[model samples]
Target: MYYDIIVLGVVVSILFSELTRLSPAGLVVPGYFVLSLHSPMRAAYTLLIAFLALGAEKLLGRVMILYGRRSFAALILLSFLIDGAIQASGIWAGNPGMIGCLVAGILARELERQGIVRSLGALGVVTGVLSLLLLAMGHPVFGTQGVWR
Candidate 1:
């Protein structure tokens, strides 16, 4: 019963964030929620997400540094892109938000390693503002109203 409630809560949070047009961070929050509801599954899921994000960050960082490109922006964008891909896969499997926390965590790790601590803090603020703006832009708050729906 507890696990069921936990799972439902995670699902609801994910769906709510989606419906309310919250920022991607909100969507990512459910990953932790879901992971907290289990042990083995959580560990496995986290491992996969971490690997994906870390691998991408390393590769992209090297590329950006080598080519003298926008490293910070690229890292942030790649983090989100990789997260979105993971979420998409989860949704296809009927477990949307299963890796939400993992995505956020992975991004956080990458950001810290790249010495973007200030920007990461800024991202939290930006995410909140964006969520509010999205809400004002006629986005719902807890239903099937977003593009994903």
Candidate 2:
């Protein structure tokens, strides 16, 4: 069979996007945010993210993986560069979304290693949903708000 480079490019894009979740920007704050939330909004956001992340990843799996696998050699390298960008952005101002991207990246890598292509997408949705929920609940999993307070 012939190789398709375009497909690989798309997957690399998605992978780079997901890997961004690893940075503090993604997990902790979102988790805290969900915890801080007060009511229905929490559930609504969590569900929204879960659906978007999982649905998008699942739907776009073939396109992303085919492209990602073909260019596997450059995947992690790109992720590292992206991570630096996230940190730099944080230094300049403040970006919680950056953490989410970092976590997504880390989760994507794990999913890939496990041979669970869909896991990346699923993780995206799940984390997205969870982040929203935590934020609505006022948890501040990683927010400036003190959890103990």
TM-score of every model? 0.34, 0.27
Residues 17-133, candidate 1, lDDT per residue (tens digit)?
A: 456444323334433333243343543454355445556767766655622235434544555676578667664353333244335453445444433443344334443444444
* The candidate that achieves the highest lDDT relative to the unseen native structure: 1
Whole-model Cα lDDT per candidate? 0.45, 0.39
Residues 3-105 of candidate 2: C-alpha lDDT, one tens digit per residue:
1222332343355447654322222333432333334343343333333343345545557663454433333334445446645766434333322333333
Q: Looking at candidate 2, what is the lDDT of residue 112?
A: 46
Clashing pairs in 1: 20-140, 31-100, 31-101, 32-101
